[model samples]
Target: MVKFLKITAAIVILLLLFYFVFFKYRQIQANKILIPATTQTLFKINVDELYKTLAVSYLKHPSQYAGTDKNSIREKIADLNSGLRIPANIYIYALKGTAKNTLFTRLEIADTSAFNHFILKKLALLKKDAHFFESADSTFGLLVNKKTVSIAFNMAKEPIRHILEEIHDQNNMVKISDSKFAQMASLSDHLSFQDAENLSKINFTDGKIDFSSEFENKWIEPAAEPRHRMLNPESTLSFWLNGKIKSDLTEKNHTMSLSLLSKDSFFRFYQDYVDFEWTKTVTQVDTIVGYEYNDDFEQVEKKILRDRKIPSITINLNSDDKAVSNYLKSLGALDQSTGKISSAMIPLYQFYFRGSNGNVQLSTIKSAKPDVKRASSDDFFYFKVDFKKLINQTSIPLIADKLGTFSQLEIKAKSIGKNKIKLESELLFLNKDANALMQVLKVFQNGFKSALDLNLSVDIPVSK
Candidate 1:
């Protein structure tokens, strides 16, 4: 009995040692994939883990897969699994100062030959060299090595090469093992993102999408008063900002609240009331007609229709200096008799305005009044959007249909430590029991079906 007990203890110790060694090896391997310090936004995804999570979610809500070809999707997923390395991570990132259209993606390749064949079968190749290829009308470029594949979208070949070179240089890249974002990302098996100012982690569970971000800088300063109490709870969209932000819109440090009453009213205020000619340049088009007198007489000119939109938002500004209001009044934007503010240079809509206790309220709604509700006292910044109410109030079918998936979105920011702030955002879905990712998949599937139905119903005249 003593010898048996000794053998059992020895086996347990060996297993423990193996686990620690394996974990450390994975950490070292992940650290080898370096990211450039100048990267503006980065997204890390665990491919195999995400697939497993999605599979479980699908089992829980099988109804969401209705009207879709399940076999086709399974086959595609299987093909991807065969080409990429399992239990590894893929990174998608954007660099600072680069165009918004440019993006970079890096993935671990399990089999180089298989991945190369997979790419060739999927994309419409525009050009190809030894190990480099351009596809999708030259908008996408791919560089495949033995163990890794790097892809760049909307980027030239030279720039992609330069970034690849920089990533291999230790001094030019960030140390992934020491990065806070990397540590947070490793905690979750799904997806995580890091940007210049913030590191965020996303989790899908409990029937809602929970996203949390940690700010690198003190973006939200502590407020002197509970300014959140000044916002109306019935507003479709409400935002509160209390910080010293240097912008042309405001000079001094102040607290501001912006509220939108309803989606219908907001759209109407912009489409029918706001004057676009004052700030926007008119787009003109030239057409060729018939030649009556000369070649120049055949030319006809017409202005293109402008579909400009601005939100019907109310602004509440609390500050010691009233320079903003004075400037508007000086420019004839505010009507002293009715206490209304109109468009600059040209009057289109007379927005309601009132001033009391050094607080200014300007809104497009005629019945706008001061109503306050204290939601939180500690949060320096808060934003909320009632998607259900907005959808119910909107006359546009497309906007209503797309936004119907979400019930509400709320975000809050508070100081966590010195020069650090925590921002938490929650998006509530209509189906409270379904997984957030499954709900998102349903949204896309339904949208595609609707588009197909619309196309089929359209009456296209047959060409003679």
Candidate 2:
């Protein structure tokens, strides 16, 4: 009994060792395929890991994960798994050539015939006699081989075929372990992207999609001062630039804001003040007398109201140098009296000016002020858009329908190292309980449905 127990333990240990060794080998192979020749934009995804993430997310919120199409999505994934090799990394990269950049998708395949059939069915293409296929518009091309599949966008068929052949023949392709951007591949569980000077990683959490990018350039310098205090929380859109103005050759920081008067007033304000060239169809009725029988005839004429939507915008400048401020005042652009600057070019709107001695605020609305304290000193560039407010205020159905999922988008860039600047952006979702990736899929599904509805509603004139 002691010997048997010892033998059983030995067998278990051997099996565990073998499993880990094989896993490590597969990982190394997968990473080799992810390495690109040129340092352009490259996206890598581990299909097996992503599905595992989806499974956990589904278990957390089954009903809200992907809604009723959850099963459909799983079945489609299964179909793909049967053809393509799962538990492997797939890459989509842009190959930069002399003239232009070509986008290529490279993935390992398990069953060539099955994947070919899958592609044909999904693209609604008939089975061709050759292994290579191109779309009718020459925008998409596909090449299939025994071990791998290559897809190119906006490229010709011959290039993709040649690329596939070269990839197969190349024995000394660079491995991800030996590449400079290898660290980015490990940043995210499922997705990572790298470019010439930037490396980005994306993570899909429960509520929000987190995207972080690092810009590695020696020319990036830290901001001299914090400018976040100039931004208004109530503004629908805000942007800040902390640098010198080339035209005036002055070192000035600028902040711009688009503040809505009220939630209900945005559409009306936009139509009245913002859109200067917008036109609306109107019918005009005119009275006319018939020449032959003395009968009264009503003549109708269509008129267009050529008014466009414009929002009241505010621009604030902060600088220690008074050159720009003095120049604007001298040019009659910044009036010191009555705190109003007349708009000579655009007669419809006038500007309100306040402040002097380098710091200034110029706005179309008299009540607009730059007293909001929302700026971060660490960030040199900051931008924010309130999608929720825009969706609530807009009367357009398409804009509201498409952008209803997002609440706010905020992007910030800050210096992290001597030659590195980290960019962080968050896309807040309305549904906090569901997974962000699942919500993205739902958005695409809804987009497709909306497109189909639009196509069906279009009136086609029948030719006789």
Per-residue lDDT tens digits for candidate 1, residues 89-181, read 666778776765577766678887777777877564554667677765566877777887677786543356555434433346665555544
* Candidate achieving the largest lDDT: 1
What are the models' TM-scores?
A: 0.63, 0.68
- Number of clashes recorded per candidate: 0, 10
- Give every collision pair in model 2: 226-377, 228-375, 229-375, 270-309, 274-309, 274-310, 275-308, 275-309, 275-310, 278-308
Model 2 lowest lDDT segment of ten: 269-278
* RMSD for each of the candidates: 12.2, 10.9
Which candidate wins on TM-score?
2
- lDDT score, candidate 2: 0.58
TM-score (C-alpha, index-matched) for candidate 2: 0.68
Cα error, candidate 1, residue 372 (Å):
6.7
lDDT per residue (tens digit) for residues 1-464 in model 2: 99999999999999989966875676666766644455356777766466556667668767663323434655655654438775456767766551145667756688877777777775644434466776766567667668876667754433455664445454335666666657755543567877778777787876688788887845434455645555456667777755332223222443221221222212221210110111121222222333332235545454444433445567655533255345455666556665665455224445566654445555665676545334547777677777776655457776666677777788887767676778899898777766677666556663443111111111222222
